[model samples]
Target: MKINFTHKLKILHPFFYVVALCFLSTKAEEDNTDLRFATQPTHQTAVLGSTVVLPCRVIPRDGTVQWTRDGFGLGTIRRLDGFDRYSMIGSNEEGDFSLKISPVTLEDDSEYQCQVSSKKGPKLRSRVARLTVFVPPESPSISPSPEVSATAGVNVTIKCESIGGRPAPELSLRFL
Candidate 1:
């Protein structure tokens, strides 16, 4: 028995078409897996010995999350001593990307970047967020003696001094 050429061609053509459709569908799915920032990184400030959270969010939550500091790029956290000081807080369930700094200090104050990337997409970065650390006020002191012994008609000068005070400090004096 001889197979009909046109009949064989018709079946093969449909088979080829189905295979092409499957391949194209996979490509479309891969293309759709793109990393996007639902909420860009925002500026954050913390007192020098306080904790702070920097906010970053990604949509779809189907990508690897990373945290990096100045001069680093597209990296994940590694374990070591004192790792508790810095950490990434978020999960696929919440779709949140955030950085937490505990007992933030001057070292933690710098520009930070949050990166996310899908399995088939390039790494994407959020807007740079700045971490500003404020040093609390120390015990203020008075210069030239807070208490001065003066005789009648004598001129005394009092000066108040402050160190490590945020937003500067206003010195005031009360005379009785």
Candidate 2:
């Protein structure tokens, strides 16, 4: 027994259509590219009342860049909520997507992300960077010294301590 050519074509019509569709969909280079994060944001440390910039760069340089703080809502970084301390620091001309936090305070310490999305291609993203803001210790409270009275020849002892300081702390002693 033999099969007709027309009957064979009818059976394979769906298979041919699928192959053609896949080829057409993947034929455009404008839809996707080698765009990716060239440099990921790294951990940064800043002293209180200072500024810090998190570095980020994309390869293609055509994608739009954005930054998001961890505590804020995940939708977008636009909602200031009376705290617009963060802002973008780079432009398309420089091909940088860094985030700048000025006058760094204890509240500015958090995690941040750099996201890049292609205008005519796919989306790319970078790893998160942590900002650590260091604040100086406040004045200490000395007990018993203010209430006790000492004579000119008598020796007096006092207690002093500084807490909440970072990166090797130091304390000074003075006699009045």
Q: How would you encode candidate 2's per-residue C-alpha lDDT over 14-101 as one tens digit per residue?
A: 9999999888778766576778787788988999989888888777777567776784533323333345666665656657766777
- Candidate 1 lDDT, tens digit per residue, 33-113? 665888777787788899888877888777777777774653465221355687777775777867778879788878888
Q: What is the TM-score of each candidate against the true structure?
A: 0.70, 0.62
| Best model number under TM-score | 1
RMSD of candidate 1 to the truth, in angstroms, is 5.8
Q: For each candidate, C-alpha RMSD in Å?
A: 5.8, 6.6
Q: Which ten-residue region of model 1 has the weakest summed lDDT?
A: 73-82
List the lowest-lDDT window of 10 residues for candidate 2.
Answer: 73-82
Give per-residue lDDT, candidate 1, residue 49: 92
Q: What is the lDDT of residue 147 in candidate 1?
A: 79
Model 2 per-residue lDDT at 9: 100
